[model samples]
Structures are given as C-alpha cells and as structure tokens.
Target: MEPESGVNGTAIAEFILLGLVESPGLQPVVFVVFFVAYLVTVGGNLSILAAILVEPKLHTPMYFFLGNLSVLDVGCISVTIPSMLGRLVSHKRTVPYGACLTQLFFFHQLAGVDCFLLTAMAYDRFLAICRPLTYSACMNHTVQRMLVAVSWVCAFTNALTHTVAISTLNFCGPNVINHFYCDLPQLFQLSCSNIQLNELLLFGLGVLMAGAPVILIVTSYTHVAIAVLRIRSAEGRKKAFSTCGSHLTVVGIFYGTDVFSYMRLGSVEASDKDKGIGILNTVISPMLNPLIYSLRNPDVQCALRRVLTRKQAMV
Candidate 1:
C-alpha cells in the first residue's frame, strides 16, 4: 500500500497483531492461562458486586466506589482478553482498523477512569481514617456521585484526545502491531504519518491522567500514614495500618508498573522481558486488584459472608 491524500488512502483496513511471539508451541498454554484469568476476573468482580448489593452495611461511599472499580476492572480486562483468546485459537491475530481504534478508545477510557477512581478511593480512605470527625459530611452521597461522574468524564476526555490524535495519522504500510493488544505507542509506530504531536499529546495526557493521580494518591497516603502514626494505642495504630495496607500495596504496584511503562517516552525498546512486564500491567493487574482489596478488607469479607449466608438461606 502507498500513502495517498485525504479520504481514500493506501492504508490497509486491518492490522496484523504480532501477539506475544510467533511460537505455535506456546499458543495453547497462553490461551488457557488468559482464558482462566478472564473467567476468574469476571467472577471475582461480580462477587464483589453481589456482596456490595446484598449487604446493607456495604452500601457506603467506599463500597459504592469499590463496586464501580470492580465493574471498570471487568471492562478493562474484557476489552483486551476475549480478542486475544480468539486470536490464539484461530492462529489469526489480525485486528480490523476500526476494531483497533475502538479497542484503544475503550481500553484507555476505562483504565484512565480507574486511575482517578483509585485516587478518589485513597482520598476516601483519608477522610475515613485521617479525618473521621467529619467523614460523613466530607464524603457525602452527593460528593461520591460527583466523584464517580468526574472520573468517567476525565477518562472519556483523556481517551478522546488520544483517539482523535491517533486517528488523524495515516498508516499506509506494515500494518502489523507488535503487541497483543492495541497500545497507542505500538500503533503509533505503525503509522506512516508523523506522530510527533501524538507522542507529545500522549506523554502530556499520561502525566495529567495517570501521573497526576499517582501524585494525589501518594499525597493522600502520606496523610493517612501520619494519621495512623498519631493514634495513641498500639492496637489502634496496627488496625489503622492494616486497614490502609491493601490500598497502599495496590497503589504501589499499579503506579510502579505504570510509571515504568510510560515514564521513558522516546525510543522505547520492547524486548521479550519488557513485553512480559507490560502484559502484567495490562492483563494481570486488573485481575489482582479486586482480589487484593476484597480479600484484605475485613469489612468486605464480612459483607461477602452476609451476602453468601443470605443467599444460602434463600436457597
């Protein structure tokens, strides 16, 4: 294909995704692993949903935000995995141009919102633990709703900027993407048109969306840790530390992978090891999040028990 001007161009309608590697021997193993992860991810998030909905005590702002987070995580994982599974089985990793763009749009939208939501949750934890005197007043229902709305809006706006920027570029030849899923950087590499603006915009938005939230989360946790330290009783300090520990671990892992993924903008070399790490961030992190939060949280555990017992009695 050759590059042409405006409208009809030399660009191909479909993109060949060179997923993971070209090893036929590894396809089945990879397929099984991802398929199981997808099932567990969906089931775990749904369990969180069921627990939250069935237990009255879990209806607070924190649980409400958590339920939202689970739902988003499910979506984030779903967009990438099913297509990957299909490709694995069929030995065809080709994605249509339109589908690639759609994947990019939704993937980033959900992922970006997840970033903001985690920050909001960190702040929620801060209000609940650090400033318990006015937790209700500070994190009221109205505020919670507003926070969720803003999360979605910010994510959509962030994704739209990148999608629009990415879509404007022309891709004339070598329409093969080097990653399993459609990442903006990899996709941009395939573009025949200049991607300097797209690259800059991507870096700017990455900082604004992901980097900014990391900063906010870090700041919130600093306050939370200080509050934990100020508790007079050793037991109280231990309990406070335990309560926020899960969130802090998640934040560290998420931001650590994310920063490593995007911090260095220019001339990124995607070695086999680098791609494996990227997959962990993109695929495994979403699965691990609900597990980490729900399992570690005593409230969620009790709420889940209540939900199960209630269901059992009904049965």
Candidate 2:
C-alpha cells in the first residue's frame, strides 16, 4: 500500500510493524504470557532498586552500580515490552512514525546505557578484587558518581546520533518494518532515501558502543580470574571467585548475544534465529542480571533476608 503524503510531503506518517509472529491464533496466548513477564520484570527490578536505596549496608559502590543497572533494565525492557504486549493482545500492530522514532530513541538509549554500566561494574569488581589495597581510594563516592554520569552521557550521545540519522532518512516505500520494533537495520533497509550515511553511522557506532567495552570487560576479568588463582588459601580463592563469577556470567551472556546480533556490517539477512537471540539479550538478559548478581552473592542475599525479615515483622 502506498503511503499518503504528510504535511511536509513525507510519504510515511505511520508504519505497520510485522511484529515477531503473525499467527492470529497465537497472539492472545503470547499476550498473556508476555504481559506477566513484563509485570515481573518491572516489579522485580523495582524491588531490587528499592532495597538498594533503603539498605544502608548496600550503600557501597557495587550495589550503587547494580541500582543503576536495575534502572537501566527497567527502561530498556519498557521500551519494547509494553508495545509488544499491546501488539500481542490487540487486533492491530500499527505504529505511527512518531511513535516508532520514540521507541528507537529510548530503546537504543537504555540499551547503550546497560552496555556501559556493565563495563563500569566490571571495573568496580576489578578494583575491589585486584587492587583491594587501593579499592577504597580508587572507587570512592566521587569516582563512582563520575563513572555513572559518564555512562549515561555516552549512552545518550550514542543514541541521539542514531535517532537523528534515522529521522533524516526518507521512508518513501514499503512502510512496513518486518520486526516487533523499530530496529536500525530493518528501518534502513525499508527506506527509499539514500541510507548510505545511516548505514555508515550505524556500523561505526555499533562497533564503538558494543565492541570497546567488551574488550575492556574481557581484559578486566582475565586479570580478575588470574588474581583469583593467586590466592594461596582455597577459602580465599573461593571468596574471590564467588564475587566475580556471577558478574562475569551476566557480562558474558549479555555481550556475547549482543555482539553476535549487531556486529554485522553488510546487508546480512538477520534470521528469526538472529532476532530470537537479540530478544534474549534485550529482554531475557536484563531480567537475569538482578537475579544472577544478587542471588549468587551472599552479601546481597543477607541484605534481602534482613529487609524481608523486617517487613515481615512489621506486617
């Protein structure tokens, strides 16, 4: 279908997102399940955020980073899931051009933030484990605040470039995005206007945003693991390993899936398998961070137990 002309003569005022799956038979079922997941995702992250804020014991730099990560997770998931829930439950999956732009802006912003925050967390762990003597001096309150501020700024700047680049493209034909959301590559493919610039920008930013920090994380943890090995006592080794293991797990899963999905440079046909894995990084992975980081850490478990016990007593 040809798009009607808009006020400024842009051909696309709205777009039809083909979404994850088109089976009308499955939409309602998908809706029920994903809506529940969305609720749990939001509620669980919020509880973690609240506990971190209220608990004086968790007022350290690690939980501070975790709290920032929880906020990022909530924002990132919210960008896609609410609309996903709506599309799954409703008869229509139409997304207006403005709304798609909004989604693109936020989806990238929050995701970029998550990537950077994870790196920050790795650095925090490195300081704590590898340089315990100077950990306090290195990761003090001023430094922690600086790291978080830099992460947000970098994320916003990265996302804004893509959003503005996307806005400049002319979507003159085939106004249907064949994905659940407004993705950069898919949208670029559908544009009738010259997208060489957008493609270049996407390629450049994709590498810079996802690649650099992954290298940092790998380096940080390589040293951390080596440091863990140097501990003379088995008990000391166990303690260090426990502290770094959960974070390393989350970072590996999140970055591994992300780099696999987005690091492509050409006109690659991203399969359903690709999209599925991307969804894992965006949706499933963020949900797992809080669980994996907190559940596996004895400190966090103790804090949660105390918080819960106090609540139960009050009740």
Candidate 3:
C-alpha cells in the first residue's frame, strides 16, 4: 500500500523503522530478550513504588523522591520498548508519522523528567547528609511535591518545544528512520527543509533539559562527599555513603549512555552501535534502577520482605 500524502504535498504519512537487526533469524532472539527486560523493568519499578506507598517507615522525603523516580523509569521504558517489540515480530515494520511524533514527544519528556528527578533526589541526599538539622524542614511533604511537579512541568515544556519545531518541517521523499525509534536527530536528517532552527533548539534545550540537572546532581554529591568525610566514626561514614551510593550509580549509568548518544550529534547517520546504546539507555537502565536500589539498601529490602510476608500470611 502506498503512503498517503500529507497536507504539505510532499510529506509521507508513514515511515519505515529499520530496526536494530536486519536478519530474520535474529528477530525472535531479540524479541524474547527485550520482552523479558521489559517485564522485569515494569514489575520491579512497580514493586518499589508499591513498597514505598505501603510502608509507613518509608514516608520520608527520600522515599517520596525514589517513588517518583520509579514511576518515571517505568514511563520512560514503556514509551519505546512496546513499539520496538511490535516492530520486531511484524514483517512490515512501519510507523505512522503522527505516531512517530508522539513517541518522540513522550520519550524525550519522560527522559527529561528522569533527569530532573535524579537531581531532586541528589539534593534530598545532600540536605540529609550536609545539613542534617535542616533536612526535614527543607524537604517537607509540600516541598517534595512541589519539586516533583516542577520537574514534570519543565520536562513537558521541553518536549513540546521540540515536537512543535519538528512538526513544522517538511519530509519530501525518504521516509525510512534508521534506528529502532523516532529520535530527533534521525528525523532532522530526513527533513527536506532547512533544520537550522530545529538544530539550534535541539542543542540549546537539550543542554538545559539534561546538562543542568547533571550539574546539580554532581554538585550535590560533592557536598555530600565532604560531609561524609567529616564523620569521625567509620560506621557513620559507611552508613552515609551507602545512602547516597545507589543514587550515584543510577545517575552515572543514565548520564553516561545519554552523553554518548546525544553529544555526538554532528554525525547525521545512525549506526548499529547507536541502537545498542539506545537499548542500554532505554531498556537496561530502567531494569537496573530497581535492582540497584533494592539490593544496595537494606531498608528497602526489609520493607519488601515485610510486604511479601504479610501477603503470604493472608493467602
């Protein structure tokens, strides 16, 4: 079937997403592997979210932000994995132009939200460790809610700006997206119109949306490290380090893959290696977040154990 022309005569209605692997033999293997990862990512993050809500002991600023993070992780993965899985099984791996735009919007929005939430979580840790006396007062329930709300608003605005800019461009002939997803850079490369404004917005807003939060997280952790060093008792220092360590690990993985992908935007062509990095950023990171937090933190483990025990007793 031929693709319908858009209002702009040259625009194609749909695009073919040339996914990660081209070989038919590898499709099933890729599907199974990613399906398991998706399930684990959803289940683990939901469990963490449920535990935080049910356990009275977890009704603190730190757990509140952790709950938000889990939610964002779940959303970020959901935006891409389902579509990618569908494309893997179907012979005709085509996505509607509108659907592609929508996917791009949500993917970036959720990613932006994840960045801000991590920064907020780091700030919470900083206050707890660096200014213990003021921690509770500074990160009260009201303030915590406000911070999460601000993160969502900022992220949504950033995604909207990019989507709107992309909508204005004309796609004349080539309708094939090189990667598994409808990423901004790939879309820019396909446009018939000059994308100078789009490129400028992508770089400027990308930095504000991603770079700012990263800077905040690093600065917060620096202060947290200094505060930990001042503690004379080895046990006290160990406890403090453990508290912040899980978050640091997650931040490192999320930022590392993103920097690799987006920082090198000068290259218009997408490679197989780029798709692998996207998988790590979108699929692997979300799955690892719950595992890292639960395994590293005894408090969360104990809370999860209690929840499971109570469920078993009722059964």
Largest lDDT belongs to which candidate?
Answer: 3
Cα lDDT tens digits, model 1, 1-315, are 223455544367788988876889988888888899999888888888988898787898878888998899789888888998999988888887778888999988998888898899999999998889999999999999999999999999999888777777887768877778887767766777777888788888888998788888889989998988888999888877776787777777777877766655564444555477667776788788777878767778887788778879999
TM-scores of the candidates in the order shown: 0.92, 0.92, 0.95
- Model 3: residues >4 Å from true position, as ranges? 1-10, 313-315
Arrange candidates, best lDDT first: 3, 1, 2
lDDT by residue for model 3 (1-315), tens? 233357553367888998878889999998999899999899999889888988888888889989988998899899998989987867778998889989999998999988888999999999998998988899888999899999889999999999888888888869888788898878878888888888889889878988888889889999989989999999999988888888899999999998888777688777787898989988999999988888978779888888778779999
Best of the candidates, TM-score: 3
Error of 3 at 143 (Å): 0.4
Stretches of candidate 1 exceeding 4 Å from the true structure: 1-10, 309-315
lDDT of 2 by residue, 97-176 (tens): 88888898998888888888889889998998899999999999999999989988998999889988887777777887
Ranking by TM-score: 3, 1, 2
Q: What is the lDDT of residue 242 in candidate 3?
A: 85
Residue 37's lDDT in candidate 3: 91
